[model samples]
Target: MQTEPNSNPNGQDVLLPPDGDDVPRVQDLDLNLLKAFHAVYVEKNVGRAALRLGMTQPSVSHALSRLRLVFRDALFVRTPGGVEATPRAQRLAGSIDRVLRILQDMLDEGAQFCAATSRRVFRLHMSDFAESAFLPTLMRELDTRAPGVVIETHHIEDSQFNMAIESGRIDFALGHFPHASSHFHFSELLQERYVLLMARRVARRLELDEHFTLGLNAPDGLHFIAVTSHPQATELLERYGLTSRVRLAVPNFMVVPAILSRCDYALIVPHTVARAFSTPGDSAMFEIDDASTWPVNAYWHRRFDADPGHRWLRGLLMELFRIGAREPFDSWLGAPLDLAPDSAHNA
Candidate 1:
């Protein structure tokens, strides 16, 4: 049988000789071979990496053996849990992943995509705002169009946008982020004004009280629930002289609706988010006086600009959320594969 002499032989590793001028060059490695190297490096286990690459354990071991000889390093050493990368492998990880993304982009640039049958899993970094205002509609639309497709959402910090998109950790992000960036493309979805929300009972009490006026400002003596995810909430509180009146501070808006219902704490949120949480009959919403607005945006790295899948998803999102879009998003300019069988099976 053909074999890598230094690969696991008789189920045991065999160390290789020293590197020489005969070492394999980068061009000597094919895309699949480099993929094997990357999978093992990231997964830190041969069997698991093999599963990720859809190959047998022995095949992955053979590929690893070739990679070790090519790079002239042990690359990884066995650990009780899995494997630990050597310094060289650690250093190679970034460039290898970047190369893979670039090559995938190049391939997808000209590839025809059949969303009706494609079972691609897209990753997105969504803020709580997007989760509330965008996810439900986007998912419902996807369900009708691509039943086999899936979405995995990540909660990431604004600072991680560039690396997250470039590393393929996230395909798209929707949040309030600084627009000035050389590496990212930002599209504004909504630049909504700030509004306050409270339980319906509380609005009734405020309306009957003789203290407030039309287009009411925040009245004195009410506590506030501050969502840390929207820093503008805090800024608005400070602007309204209610900083010390903040009763509770939470990381996200997930529980704000419940809190508003159970307590008299006022919630300062973007008009879009407030719309999602506000009950027309049961919740009171007041437009607070301020030019201060929260901007929701979609961000992606420039490196993925040409990827067909990436472009398709981005265009779908833009059409789904942008204020004036009337049609279902479709970026596929060319004819799609005849995927009737696949669609029938997946459905």
Candidate 2:
């Protein structure tokens, strides 16, 4: 096994080959060059990877050439479109990932983690609805576990999300999954249902039952309002037979509770979101569309699938909800209502 050259100013002791490990001896190889290697392998583009490393394209090309000569193997092969990892490159990718993680830990040793004592900044992207629902509680848990850690959140609109995640502009995205591609590693964090929200005054005017009889009979003047922060809102409303009217359309879901609190405007949003936005003394859920539900998912590029920090945050979010990847509606919803129309409707 070849030993790569020591690039750390702290000397070779910084990253020693494992346990007299039988890895190749690359005493002449600059270990710092591996950073470039990892970036190229992950990005699959020399020019883009160089840009990521803040280096010129020619320098990245030269470093890659030197690596190929030292290893005596063609690590990557260029296709007509882009570069593809060769067999050796594939094997090296995992090792490189581990090495980079260790490098990060080394750089932050002064900020030694006791978990109980570590304070760090984590970034996440979420739609407005998710921000209202999970950010508060998630922050509370973080405050207890890692009090110094600050969570920075960015809004991911339906239009800008796909590009944002792919380009690594955001760490991870949280929301009901749109009709997305398989390139992302997405996990279902929680199951949530869409609920109809109305002012208490309006709900009281309609003497409704579990079937929402008076709600169906309410005058059209109530004027349905829909939050378009998510693409699903409109489709969900149409699915439940309310497509003709949209008296108000807002991009932010957090503003919804205020709007509903002041007017007879009825809005549709997830149950968890509705609960979070409801002011204790000011608002209430007028109706819940028990039938319409979707899994709230955490999405990240496959490039980050094995990243320790990213994985930890995703797991923490799941743990806070006391649910696993595919929790059912019953696990979260308080009461089950069968929205299926039966022979009573036929009569």
TM-score of each: 0.58, 0.56
In model 1, state the lDDT of residue 66. Answer: 77
Q: Which one is best on lDDT?
A: 1
Candidate 1 lDDT, 83-170, residue by residue in tens: 8888988998899899999998877757866779979999988878777878778888899988888999997765776778878898
Counting clashing residue pairs in each candidate, in order, gives 0, 10
**What TM-score would candidate 2 get against the native?**
0.56
- lDDT tens readout by residue for model 2, 1-347: 55443222111222223234244566856766798899889888878888899998878877876666555555766765567777877998898889889988887764434556656577788767777767777877787887877788987666878778888778778877575558988878777777766665564455333356223444555567877756666776676567576788887776776778777777776767766765443444645444456778888888866665666676787676647644333344333323222234334
Q: Positional deviation of 121 in candidate 2, in angstroms?
A: 2.0
Weakest ten-residue segment in model 1 by summed lDDT: 327-336
Model 1 spans > 4 angstroms off: 1-109, 208-217, 324-347
Clashing pairs in 1: none
Residues forming the 10-long window of minimal summed lDDT in candidate 2: 6-15
- Stretches of candidate 2 exceeding 4 Å from the true structure: 1-113, 157-163, 179-181, 213-221, 235-246, 280-282, 286-291, 322-347
